[model samples]
Target: MNNNSTGGLPVAETCNERITSPTSNLGPQFTLVVLVLLAILMVLLALITVFGNGLVILAFLVNKNLRHRSNYFFLNLAISDFLVGAFCIPLYIPYILTGKWIFGRLLCKLWLVVDYLMCTASAFNIVLISYDRFVSVTKAVTYRIQQGITSNTIARMVSVWVFAFLLYAPAIIIWEHVAGCSIVPDGECYVEFYYTWYFLLCASVFEFFIPCISVAYFNMHIYWDIKKRKRNRLRSTVSISKRVSVPSKGNGQPSRVSFLLKKEIPSLDLETEDGLSTSSRTQTPPQVMDCSHLSTTSGNDRSAALKVKTRSKLHKDKQIAKSLAIIVSVFAICWAPYSLLMILRAACHGECVYEFLYEITFWLLWLNSSVNPFLYPLCHVRFRKAFMKILCPKRLAVLPPSSQSSLREPN
Candidate 1:
């Protein structure tokens, strides 16, 4: 088994007693089958992780509609996941199957650094996405106003990578030398401080616990904000319609209809001593008909247009919030088990948790990378259409350019 049960060199340590492969007890035939299956599964995960996130990056690059400020965070996430598939997963496959770190100490250190950096950056990007959605939901005006500013988005993206690197890179690099000895065996590679419960606690808190908490809090508020907005919008729309349609005491017609008529109707005829003034009626211009028609219809038209606009805007915001919530949820699910197990193992000095469980949960983290590509399309129609357009341009040729632009998410 690898040094870390959590899969990556960043994960929890597997003690000496449980270093044997899980398939050791099985018959040779069964073990071979299991190994073959595991190899294929891991390879597929690497491919999926690569292509899925790669597609996102590609789509973002080619599609101007997806160039919104908020999407830059997603782009950063895809870049991290892509690196995972491209570098981390591929490197780990050889060590995992062979049960030895033949890749050398230098490569192991590099792998540990790259793996932890990408994984931590992925978590940070998720936090940023959640925070962005929360702000867009609760403080939409401010978020929209700042949408045009590219520097802020760029800074946030850079900070995610920087903070992620700072979180674990220094410790991973200097822990062995600082401690005056390496905990890792000659044939395996893992963090030297796996036995340090304090370090694991701190790292886990920053890595999984804090990110998960922030995302949950933000998404909860987002849900509440969306619900409140929907309720308020419905109430306002109903009240406005009621006010517009309510019968007037004097005319028995809607007050708005009476008001429009009073304001728009022309005084074509004047009262003369005997009766109506015929000459004044004759001088009434033809534009009177057009003006009267416009006054009455324009009010209704404007009301309907405004209502549609408001509904569409709310729907778009809700979809975005929903998509972000799903992404955060997936991140939590993928990382939480491994993170908890890691902390538990660290606290117990690697005795309490089973090796197999750690291995299982470790793969679950990588599963997040593979699964993320599909989740966006499942939750977001815009991403789905954009992906479809990229994948099957001929099929979507019938769709007008206006339709594509209309589907663009609001910044």
Candidate 2:
């Protein structure tokens, strides 16, 4: 066994001894199988996450259409994913295989910090994207003017990095080395459970709870607004029908339906109209129709359609947010059991009957990190398109002018 001192912990041992050490108590066959499986999974996950996130970044950078303020959040998210895969996975896979943290004290702490920070950043980015979408859809005019692509993009990028660093700062301050031999005799590093919990709680709040609430609330508001708008539209249509059905001024000529049709219906101004405006406007022109009147009616119809589309888009966003929330929540839920079991084991200095369950939970948590990239593509159309473009570039190539002009433009 090898040994070195850093923050009061022992290190320096042969890799094979670390793997087969009696301290680990893992049989040769079992240990070999676990290591093999972990290696395979890590390799696969690293490739997927790296390539998936890389495609997202490439899409944003290369496509002028995608280089908008709203997409900045996604760019940050992609960066977070890439960092996690590059920095976290390589270190973690070795540790898992060796069953010990052979890396030095500094590296261990740094890895822990990076892992937490990147994961938090990723979650926060998703929340920001949801919020941006909400604003763009609900208050589109304001979004276009006040929160344009450049300013909002820079602000969000800065905020994500700043928040990530702040979130991880506590870990650096609180982390301390604890004495333990890893499953691999050669692997040894500080394990700071106290700081781990702190990090987890902070991450859970910023990453999971806050985003979940913000997305859900906005989506609910959008839904309610849509329903209200639909009702108002139906009422307007009924009123217009009633007006059209009314007989012409006692002329007994079938009430000249064309004349009524030519008359412009009052515009439905949801933003400006109050109860008083409705009452006051009752005395306005009852028959005169002008182009401006037609334009207003057309504008209201467009606005109503836009609201419906916004509501639909928000509903999809809500589902994606909910799915991500569930992913994080399930991670916490699944991991909590084992963490508690380990804590009990440490405190009581006794064996726990739920070792099997603990192992299952730990593996499940690992699976969470592995599966997120795949889930993202399924939940997001942009990500899906990016993935397809990456996988089959020729298929996504721009068409000739004749074909291109015919394709519906992106809003």
Candidate 3:
């Protein structure tokens, strides 16, 4: 459609108007002193995460007793933590110093991909652990009697990792890292989420909010189940003791002790002086009785042993559940800030309300990976023993140092 007849042909207006955003330039900004300190701290944390998780994995691998279907989740956790610390956290240092993501488009996408994927893995792993424990505690009686873990434990664990992957893979698959040098001298790469809002919403819900709520609910049920089992055990114990100690009147059954007493002790035949009765005078010499109570006492002993063994197993399972709770508690404390900020960022549609706040949360969330290794040994005696066997074998054979220190001054 050329308008050549008009002496002065009007030119088509080009759509070159720029759209501006207040936060377009807002990136990670930290003071020189703070940034240096933060970088050093992050370095240390990353090192700890790598090394600590390595030790955890090694300990699990080396110790045959630690090899259980549930502990496999910890191994998965170690790998996830290692990835977060090694790949995801190190990328932040450059961002903080330059106030821009300078790691290039490929790396920028990689960072976001690894960040969400592994973090989701970690979160959902905890959920898996909690649900597993809930199952264990709730089905304590059947579980102990069966003497085997349920068949679905492995399936549940696999499902957790799969869900984590599927939830965050879209973020990477739909990733459009727009790169431009004119945006800044150093160059800029952005994870554009405007077109992926629905994906982001679903990922956020499935990967975080729902999982957290479910974990908390499952842990509560586990706690109640443990308490209920404890009460039932106490009731059964009291009833057993009463049955053994109290005699049943007008019934055919006597008390356990009385039955044994009556069986073991025979009547003493006495001689009557000046009586001519042959039955009383030279009665059968007080015959030695065979141990008549042996069978009853042995049977009682076997039942007691069975009870003790069952109690020990339950106690061990409870301890394991408690140790897992400790891990989850620590994880919750460290991850809450990150998850909350992530929700805020998601709600804002990638328009974060504050600068540098998410970075702080990022640091907090990374702290969990570093802390998990230490929490295991501290909270669980089995892990403590395994660690000691791995690191301080000589010291483990020796008795632990007394809590009452002789070096302390008399108060």
Candidate 4:
């Protein structure tokens, strides 16, 4: 057996090196222990992925507030992850342990197609997620995304699934549709199709490389926009404070001229009993001015309300953008090594496809699928609250007020 490690896991294949076989070097006890550990890990991963993505979907179904235009992408992603957890990861365990595809020819081909389909769909969904966040962050000030999101949402979801299917179509075409080359040996159930090079190239390029570049580009733009918005807000606050702090000529009172310029002169600016201009009434205490009435001015109130609303919206959008950026980053990290290995395997032409390394990389990809649910709690208070409401309503009922603080959006 050859040696290759992915994510610190040793991958060894057995027998003729075509499929996995046990090592002669490691004793049976050690191998059994390893197998048991791998089984436990795989089962645990699959369970968490199913349960977590289920919660994400449940949150969407129940929480009307979360059923927004942007969140539709999340729903799509959850579905794809659920498929990965339920369909892809579990089938892998037996193959790895037994070193053969004992599941028969038809089922093996079916498994290969489903595995490729779900994994491709998951990748495409992430691309959609990045695109959605980028649009939200870039166009929030200009567009009522909510008004037009239905059409956009439908189009995106359809496109993601369709394109994902197309990306993996070559595999199905070569292994099943092509008449002469589609045959698998008797009792074998692996993905050792005829077009390994083309399959690996297409899979790596479309699923990994292109998506990685798109995610990085979109997130960079979103990040830059957030910084620009924060800078503008800081400048506005500083300008307001400076304007408010200006004192008239040697008196400790703030300038009436500045306040008048800002608020269009309150009713108190009218001629006093002494008939002096409002600015000349230095002896009058600034507190005497009816700032409350000025604050209530329709134009001023609207302006302040607009500023507050805009600030809050920007804050929320930025938080969401950051959360999605983390998700994208996690996806890249999890999938990169797998993509690399795919390229290597293609280059080696099946000579170096280590069972253990492939499994390690495969699990890493699933890790991304499983992590989405946990990320919601880490980045968004609303999702955390929604999750708790679904998972443990009784526990949340007696939840400490301080614990609610955990729901705050991360910095």
lDDT tens per residue, model 4, 202-268: 6689899999899888888888877876676566544545444443444444356456534432221
How do the candidates rank by TM-score, highest first?
A: 1, 4, 3, 2
Task: Tell me the tens digit of each residue's lDDT in model 1 across 71-188.
Answer: 7887898999899999999998867777667789999999999999998998898889779878876766567678889999999999999999999999989876655555576667
TM-score of each: 0.79, 0.66, 0.70, 0.74
- Global lDDT of each candidate: 0.72, 0.54, 0.58, 0.65
The candidate, 2 or 3, that scores higher on TM-score is: 3
lDDT digits (tens) for residues 305-342 of candidate 3: 43564466456556766776675677777877766666
The per-residue C-alpha lDDT of model 4 at residue 148 equals: 52
lDDT of 3: 0.58
Candidates 1 and 2 compared by lDDT, better number: 1
**In model 3, what are the clashing residue pairs, if there are any?**
none
lDDT of 4: 0.65
Stretches of candidate 3 exceeding 4 Å from the true structure: 1-29, 140-157, 175-186, 194-199, 247-314, 349-352, 397-411
- Please give me the total number of clashing residue pairs in predicted model 1: 0
Candidate 1 runs further than 4 Å off: 1-30, 246-299, 398-411
Error of 2 at 201 (Å): 4.2
